[model samples]
Target chain A: MSQHISFVQREELKNKPSSDALGFGVHYTDHMFVMDYEEEQGWHDPRIIPYGPLTMDPAAMVFHYGQAIFEGLKAYTTPDGTVQLFRPDRNMKRFNQSCERLHIPTIDEDFLLNAIQQLLLKEKDWIPTEEGTSLYIRPYVFATEPFIGVRPSKQYKLLVILSPVGSYYGDQLSPVPIYVEEKYIRASVGGVGEVKTAGNYAASMKAQKEAEAKGYSQILWLDSKENKYVEEVGSMNIFFKINGEVVTPELSGSILNGVTRNSVIELLNYWGIPVREEKISIQEIFDAHARGELEEVFGAGTAVVISPVGELTWKDQTIQVNDKNIGPLSQRLYDTITGIQFGKTEDEFNWTVQVDEVRV
Target chain B: MSQHISFVQREELKNKPSSDALGFGVHYTDHMFVMDYEEEQGWHDPRIIPYGPLTMDPAAMVFHYGQAIFEGLKAYTTPDGTVQLFRPDRNMKRFNQSCERLHIPTIDEDFLLNAIQQLLLKEKDWIPTEEGTSLYIRPYVFATEPFIGVRPSKQYKLLVILSPVGSYYGDQLSPVPIYVEEKYIRASVGGVGEVKTAGNYAASMKAQKEAEAKGYSQILWLDSKENKYVEEVGSMNIFFKINGEVVTPELSGSILNGVTRNSVIELLNYWGIPVREEKISIQEIFDAHARGELEEVFGAGTAVVISPVGELTWKDQTIQVNDKNIGPLSQRLYDTITGIQFGKTEDEFNWTVQVDEVRV
Candidate 1:
């Protein structure tokens, strides 16, 4: 590493063999990566600093205007003790896409990947060796400008933080139940729906809570204009299998173009599974379920590689998919992706990024 | 005032003169009021401290989840130098209403009002004495929890920041041109649109930018579901006069429940002006303009008491309202409200709150 890029080490952590107990975003690592962007100097001061509080002006644009975007991926410690990341280039591309949408300045992909690899290599011990356990990495950028104008902020700050996360499924992998939200729409066409911005998630909290209150795991958002077509589940892209053909929502301006969603499409294409992206209305899904044509339904995201949907409740009607278990395609996609990520499979796509040598 | 409840006096800013140049939300006084709340204990440790940066965890829920709400009102320095606020109790009530929607714990109205009054008193000299200027006060509450959960945060912070502001109309109160946005929607029914949350404003930035790019002062948002009904203009509630009837978009769950909107309703009622809060579709407004029924259009908000809509461009059609000037009723309502605010008229509705003396 270059002397200028060197970070002061301040290890303050207890070694915990609690990978099995890791929940999503609950337990963080000891160190975090940071880089400051000044208006005159561009992005600079990149360093891996100890995780702590950040002092900010109360009038910072991010607090008042919600000009923030984030990316999510994981670092996996393979069975052979090598730490690797899955398709980080895809994430960096999507991160820049989100930046373009949110008006945040873009960071160079090589620099971001280099910084992340450096940090991960130093903290490789935080990556869980157990299956379905990994070091979840969150790279986010936000407007740091102190002005209170409604315009896009000029100054921004980018930071990366890591958390050791367990399987999205606590102990066993089972399909989850979801509620159909017809009244609340997460995003609309021409809106910032495709971006992984803070505002998009903040807007969905109420709907998520309402679904959870009614004993549902997630919410299935519909298109804002018509409230008829299926858009996306919060934080995940959904897919349905009907008549042995896979159908996912089209990349309308309002739905997130997820990295995992794209990966699933590639995997399905490789397996010669017919996949279509078009407007699939709620009524059509219900009709497919009634005729027993809907064989399976699943949600795709980084956290849960492929979350099969067991049941969907819309209005007063509830539709159950085939066999409350991971479907054949879903299982295969998860295995293939995970295998590649853990360096256990052929590097056909060259998706894995190996970390450099460093001690925690 | 009790010494325990008072803020330490920082008299460095006592010599600043009130001018129209001291515009809205720009110039701050020396001190601010704050209170903290934890799940273990409700709101406590109320203090008036020097205005400065706040130390926050990078993972604080507000930055990530947009769990924040705020209210805006002004402290007017009357012709006789007596400081007063217009309908502060209404703002306090609305502030709590916004809190309930965002799941931020509420504070007692009396305590909040008293704290604001004390703060205003300390900075009474900062209240602009210019004809259209006032001291803008922003009271906000945000999630302070340092976790990445989607649920409502357990810890919260409430703060009141004051800034001396001049008239929103720079140099002149001229009518502004607006562009109707047919593509993007600001808020939707069953969403947090009615609540003055940060997400609502954040969501409007793109639309506003698009409008600004087209040389329009602000964007006129339409209903998300149909994109046909007139919802509200950016940061303001809209009013339309068609065929001698005063009509405003009803309190659809999507539009904000603006304090100025409510005040206009009451004033129209007091003046025996026939008013209706029914759906005002864009088609109806355009048809009315074609038939010479659309007489006047204006916007109401705290910043600008009444901003007349000069012209509206919807798609390819452009419609002019009364040669882009303030209408008769618009002028009367603006005068009445500002008259009452500046103590130039009788306090018939008892809507003003007198500032308490700052004891230091």
Candidate 2:
């Protein structure tokens, strides 16, 4: 898979911007890598074309049945002006996991990694130099077959697009408030909860909007079954520190196996911090709060390394943690992860993939 | 809403041979109805346009976040040369319910119905006159905003595409074999199980495929929490006849309020059948089967109306229903529902909506 390399030169960008303001996903870099998979062709037509709109049939399976999967990672411009990706192998593995669940064709890991590296190299200038900014890479696969059937699609399109993103924490890394929803479940067992598919996030928007309407930053999703155990915070995995031990929900098939969540587990283990991946019920956390054993609570994801859980509102109960400020563990975890990503710390795990320079 | 009428001429369709072979969703009608919604403009630009590809941004909310909702109904041509829709108002109301759950704006029921009628009148010829054949109408909405942020899209596009469909049950309406999955759940109690959202269907595809691999036609889902209570099949609502009583799962938040399910209840009530909506535990079902009290089991939806459940395999215990054929109640229900739909019987419930011919 690594030996087979097919690269297509993209037409020059028609309207390249200089010094543009950083917006979320509004702007795209010069090129996008695309690959098509048909039952007959078996993953052919690999090309890198100029970033533009994709023409898709109205009855495409992705549009109607939501047979779509996506992955998110970032390319950082380090202090020494070199572009690098953090733990792209993890993203690739998770991407394949998503493909398997959605019945989409899985690409060779080496091929995907090499293609993304080449794409980033071609559009390296898009990586932001600002301290808290980077180029966000989006890899998505969807059913492109023009059919109205509710079955697995035979045709698929895989694409990778790049967008420069500003700081996800906004201006300051302030602790954010999250509303606890006992009524809505984000994912469930036997469902595509562990997969990074589009439906999980789409199903969460209504509850999220309700949380925002109630003056909260995000929604903390509870387990669907009993609604007693803590699941996730939509886009991120959660952590609760009680009795000086870090506790997060075990992979119950209803919560995403986030990359950042895995990183935190490894980092905590390396730092000799006790971390337990077991069921953490809401009552236990409240009980721990009553006993002064609840130390800190935070969320981990690719966007934000660790967002401190400032306050929680669940069923007429409000629990505040660490006086609305980032806790020691949260700060340490964020610094360690970002430090490794930006090349400030030693790459003991060798997670960074160096982007080769391309001569213009 | 009725005063605001915007129309586009229907484009001519290419004629295909009668024996062209019909696949599930492969072929589509020539024209499609589209409308846009925004915060500033409530609902505008309603028109029928040539069916073709849609140009969407790579980062559109629907592509990445899965913020999509849809409804499925059909236009049937009666023997009297009139085109009609079966329980379209129910579909419209359910469509709004789905929209509310997804945070998408709702359209006026009358306006949507009028638009659909106009569109169907133009494409009346596309409706097949063959027995058990009709034009499947699909109305779907998606987030069109190109943003990477995790929020509801302010801009949305609603479109209706029509496809000619044959009988879901082939020549002989044979009862289907189902796999009862106790390990996986199709939906959780507080999830988007009730809404006709794409995410719910997306979540069920894996389980459906697994059941198919086991030589079963569908999967019988269990409650997400304990996997104790029987919920529903992915595409249709399930019902059981035990001890001379019609029993179905109650309207739990995790189950869809299917229009077909409701109509069956009404028809049963009119026919003096004792129907009850309650939590029917899997254990109870199995016990009844063992006691020879379980008379029949069938699924109900718009596509098939009523499909009998012949055999169910649950945890190494395969239970075959009486005689492995359609039960008396199922056959009668199917006859009554399709009779009303095709204008072969009295429209006691006034479920049919007539499409008047217009000189354009």
Candidate 3:
């Protein structure tokens, strides 16, 4: 064990599923990391326990007030059979930001990160090694105070569960058709849109289902105020290439600062690509498409990694990007990120946090 | 004890607390109503179970994607010692609106209302008869499917829990100091603000806490885009009395349609008072204050009924309303609404739905 963490193994470990059966967030590991927080006692009793159900009072504030936030990252099993996490410190930093916004107490990021590695060591067999497969890690915090009032909760629970899964979008990288929505909004400025809180995703589900019913993969959200400037596509930050210049919307305090978006930007800067985060409106994108300057469109997020937009339909005006194929830059970003993740390429950015090499 | 409803009595019900100890959403009744929903099976298995903790998977969608919505209404003990729910059908309608927006299934409103009455009847003794007290009924629905994906859950849990709550604010109709917020937003047009969902409240907690830290009771939000037009107050719909006329923000598809707000409007219309739902700007309110036309400001919702605003502090400018006393109009609205609730006056509008008093 890496620290003072306690573990209770399952009575009987179940057989692992066939590698082919691993999909996104459907299957879980044998154990999880659990901790609790109180206004007075602080976060205490860090332990690893058998994965099971959680018992909560019906009046838990999380059910009524939505005082919850979560972080999603993955643990990759490298080609040399070593397990590593991608930029876990960044996730922890972002996690604290969410905690601050939701009025939850902060935790020792290094302690929690070490505890995550320990929990992973306890169930390292669950890490999938097939091509494009790894264990998806979900570390989340939620209000546990048993009250229905509309105030911040004084008690909370922080849990980290591991799910061995395949690709987030599909079995392979694919360009998805997105519908530009002008009616419903995912978020607006001065809202809880800059963090990975549960409510932001809840607010976006309606538009997502509407787009899904129309055979679109996701909803391309515009700014809620004027509904002109692009905000994001589904849960991911968006990027567009026009006249060999890459552009995305500014943070604007209403869109999530996606981790993959940051990584992609870093990778773009490394490659000396002309990338800028500024206000890019839907009309501007359409104009670029009309002028043959729109080269590519893609989304970046932890879950989907890199998702290219095949066709964008705005008010029945459908247009294809890069001839309905993934752009070379998008493919390169995906390949380099995943290659570094799987240790197939050089770890030039020192992004991956390698787990301890102690044998089980 | 009711149609299509099963009951599980507690082996040893705890003694009821003294009426004086009843606080908001803290003290629960002995039992709760629960139902489950599946995409294929619809909502089924409605029953009443002993009040206790509910066991849910750690990866339940409500903890992750925040796919949940809730409604609040109160059951008043009349002077005749009979119970009545105030326009519960409106709450049911609003609940369905939230359900639709969050991609949850709607229930049979009449059936659910009847079930609520039955639940209240089973726990009738817990209903407080204190001058300003009632049984605060909370009916909530949440996504229950154990998955980490960001889509609506196929399985849902609908629960109705009862709490014997005292006054929402202080007793005796005290006027409160509200902060006029210009930084953080509650919701925007074309957003999920028009419904009673957890995310909408989650989106406001940050600003609410900020206002509270500044020594304010609640926040008075402005429009998200312009941050100019008055939207709604925290957890209530606000009304402004100016120059012998009453006005509230129109239903702009981003603020909750409070049942009490509707009743207040209807009550004003019945009394031949000039009332309108239109865009009222904060600057206009300041101008009205300057012109001595800002007569009174009160918030309306099912919990508090009517909360008078004594002062509003915006951008370091604190302006007192009605000289920091309850204005005549605010007092009248509170008195009339609460009077009808306690059966002190005639139910002219046919608002209260009298629960059938079959011998228990």
On DockQ, the stronger of 1 and 2 is 2
Q: How do the residues A1-360 of candidate 3 rate in per-residue lDDT, one tens digit apiece?
A: 234778898998877887788777888888999998888988987899999999999999999989889999999988889998899999999899988887778888888789888888988889888888888999999999999878888999999999998866555678999999988988888888889889888888888999999999999999988889999999899999999989999989988888888888899899999999998899999999999999999999887889999999999799999999989988899889988988898989999989896222
User: What is candidate 1's lDDT per residue for A137-227, written digit by digit as tens?
Assistant: 9888887787665677778888898888888876555888999998787887767788787777777877888789999999999987778
Tell me the tens digit of each residue's lDDT in model 3 across B294-323: 999999988889999999988878889999
Interface root-mean-square deviation, candidate 2: 1.2
Model 1 complex DockQ against the native: 0.51
Q: What fraction of the reference interface contacts is present in each model, in order?
A: 0.46, 0.82, 0.77
Query: Between 1 and 3, whose DockQ is larger?
Result: 3
Q: Per-candidate DockQ versus the true complex?
A: 0.51, 0.77, 0.82
lDDT minimum window of 10 residues, candidate 2 chain B:
B16-25
On a 0 to 100 scale, what is the lDDT of residue A318 in model 3? 96
| Candidate No. with top lDDT | 3
Q: How would you encode candidate 2's per-residue C-alpha lDDT over B1-360 as one tens digit per residue?
A: 854546666455677425235545667888889898888988888988878788988778888888888999988878787888998998999999988888888999888988888888777767877777778899999988888778888888999998888877755467999999876677887778888888677667777888899899998998887888888876889999999999999998888888899999999999999999999888898899999999999999988889999998889999998769889999999988988887788899888988888211
Q: Against the true structure, whose TM-score is highest?
A: 3
- Per-prediction CA RMSD (Å): 3.0, 2.1, 1.7
- Residue B211 of model 3 has an lDDT of 86
Sort by TM-score, top down from the best? 3, 2, 1
Clashes of each: 2, 0, 0
Q: Between 1 and 2, whose lDDT is larger?
A: 2
